[model samples]
Target: MRNQLAISSLMGLALLAQTPIGQAASNLVFCAEGSPAGFDIAQYTSGTDNDAAEPIYNRLTEFEAGGTAVVPALATRWEVSPDGLTYTFHLREGVKFHSNKAFTPSRNFNADDVLFTFNRMLDKAHPFRVAYPTEFPYFTSMGLDQNIKSVEKRDPLTVVFTLNKVDAAFIQNIAMNFASILSAEYAEQLLASGTVRDINMQPIGTGPFVFQRYQKDAQIRYKGNKDFWAPERVKIDQLIFSINTDASVRIQKLRKNECLVTLNPRPADLPALKADKQLQVIEQAGFNLGYITYNVRKKPLDNLQVRQALDMAVDKKAIVDAVYQGAGQLATNGMPPTQWSYDDSIKDAPYNPDKARQMLRDAGVKEGTELTLWAMPVQRPYNPNAKLMAEMLQSDWAKVGIKARIVSYEWGEYLKRSKNGEHDISLIGWTGDNGDPDNWLGTLYSCASIGGNNYSMWCDEKYDALIKAAVASSDRSQRSELYKQAQHYLKQQVPITPIAHSTVNQPLRASVQGFRVSPFGRNNFSGVSLAE
Candidate 1:
């Protein structure tokens, strides 16, 4: 039986493919580090959610592999107005949504699908938006509704979006995972039933893979879309995502050939993985960050002096060497160096424990005051070892005569508690969804993100205004200046100390080909093929 295929066999897959199904290279397996909360990237911004939603959906545009160049996806082509406030997209013809045990699409992708998909996110009065919970986290954070005035179906193949104001990030922003096109017909039927289940579980999109089933925290299965638009189709007929939370277990499974690809192996494991002849390690400087956030709502943390003291006290180089194993660059600002308009002049605070102690004393903060330090329980592409980083921080704070108590919760609970301003300080970070600087400063530091993804709860009106003005202009020089000024506030106030940008390491079997990981750290497996 196919189920009994030998995991220990040293021979190539060509020898096993005597059967017709095997000849088609019909099966592939992957070991994902964590289970997704759900499949909707629009509702959630975590990489875990991206892992679940990305395979089943297609956006109007997408970034090229390992770079930020905008490329066409579901949309064959597009154009922008001279004013930069209007965008028109030409939809690709004959692209079919996946059909399976779930509901199927009655027609090909068109302007109506784009209209329905975006309108539900931007228009509160839309039937689907009114029928269901209408929180699109990433879209709301970007304030797309305020920026986007209207989405109109110009024709069967053409759709136009008119923005209330100019946005420099518009083109790149639309390519984000949050902007994934939904199958309008499928959503309409589900809403009509008056009980639409979680869309992630039964996602319907015009992508290359069809969602088969998901056993939460266990496995996710998919079948290749035979009606895919690409001339070169998905070479693997079947794909299985094995959920293994423990990194050691994932590495063990990969070594045993139980899985062909593994995600987020620790930095310490790089030497062994590189030495292994059976595997190929793919690592790149990711567009991501790992940092400490000071909750401005708290007493000691609210003080700028205390925040700066903490920033200066912690040695980022030590953390980088110990945690990242030299797999990344030390971040000076919130945005990673890989992103455009990154203000390199805003350097990291000097590691001076003496100055930190003196600053705390001058701020009237007593030595040895107990404060909570929250650590992340899960490993992310940006943060390889949150607990280790937290421990390192605690040791450094002690040198500054501050008593730090390390605390941790489950992955979801940690994010929830941190967002609610429940901690004095927290370990957190972000992976850029798009190449835009507004994605970093606007979504993160702006007042709009407070009480949500902005864990620090430190919102400066001037900082907000700078980013607001930055997004409003199409001029690169003007936007760069505004972003640089906005970053100056972060450097001076030290609300959130920018830490390090990781080099994401995704290891795969030697036989796996066409598997390119994006610089934004998204997983795109549509182009992948398994060979003997």
Candidate 2:
């Protein structure tokens, strides 16, 4: 029951030594929830706690976690066609496997590897999609297979991707690690049997870390891939990702030096961890929105005036202060400020009780119409103080003569119900998928993606048209203009109120040199090493 809020002054660079503490192994112990639960690179989807697949899988291009646009990972360099419809990538050479096998006669990564990964995503029998059905279901049926004009191997060193049309976001799509290149030779063995768990379990990728072993609900081990292309930069010799679900337990491990890095540390643990001279905290603002969504497709919420009434009734600033404890800021626009397209002209939801009462009365929800409010478990911050928000709204709406009931569910199941639009109102948080404004707006508001993550089920044809145009147009300036209009429309409608943009409260042991938390939520350890 302690709420600690203090920032440590470890702002600049610190020296690292080759040797580590305690174990001769020199492993960086990190505590987080084991997400994706399994080792299939293709199956790894976002959410949950663990960044399990990153070490074993190498994407064609990857954003440097905390850094900007895609930097070269597996592919050494690439070129675009004169028409912008095709891309040719020249692969890096001499990357050996964890199996200690010799580099194939090609001496470079090949087109066949990329082809296998894309085709495998379309394969219905694959278990990779099973790990994250909601998110990847669209990937399987993304219509990329039929639309891909062709995929040709120019030679061992080059691969060509020809699209049916000039899809500007194609590069961004490949940057998604889901399009990670697989070993054609190994994948062939799995395809012959029409199953791939065995090969996926033991992945072979050209990354800094090589998979060692995994113990379910306990740990996953990896040894450094010394022969990696960027060997000089990837200093860490090994990484041991420990699965510690309890937030308090994770913090204690950081204090005891049992773990080098602790993610999602409770806000209360910050001051104590800062007091421990051997520890530090890096607080970065993120583009994540934590809001209470009213499923407008369902009964009470189906009423527009009622939606407006609730929108006007809730005090977002108070919630941001009391619940989030000033760890985050109030959101005025649908898109988070981190996104480039967030328009500054949009207004925040004003707390107007008189307006809320009039709107509810106009909606015909007489004196005591009871509504059910849904929430998630209190473990992680999908509104740990959601009951407080619900109670506040219940009292606010009562001034307008409406009654409210509260309900809660486990995180995963709660997400499922919210997706189905089954609840009147539910609390949810959205982290940016690819650091793009389109990622936030398109996923939540695009009519095409309804019932997926667009839990509110709010629809507007004009808004949908503008979003579609923005996605298709390749011009950055024009696209930005169109999205600005789209955001304005969303603000006027208010299907979901823009709540608080929460900050990540991360704690790191002082020995954990070069450890930093990324807004993107990727566990980047490229610069990480132990203090001497």
Candidate 2 residue-wise lDDT, 1-532, digit = tens = 1112111111100111123343433667777654344555444344552267767667777776575477777778899887777888887776654553422323345677776666556544544434323234224222344446767789877888787765556666676656766677665555566555655556667677877766555566677888777776577776777766677877877776677786766555667776888788877886588776777777768777788888888887877777677677888777688788778889866799888888877877777888777755543433435666667767766777777787876554666677667788777767665666666777676665565667687878998888767766778888889899999988877788777777776678776666656666667676677766
TM-score of 1: 0.92
Off by over 4 Å in 1: 1-24
TM-score of each: 0.92, 0.82
Model 2 scores worst on lDDT over the 10 consecutive residues at: 6-15
lDDT for every model? 0.82, 0.67
Measured by TM-score, the strongest candidate is 1
Cα-lDDT of candidate 2: 0.67
Candidate 2: list runs displaced more than 4 Å. 1-25, 37-45, 97-109, 122-150, 194-204, 212-217, 366-372, 378-410, 420-422
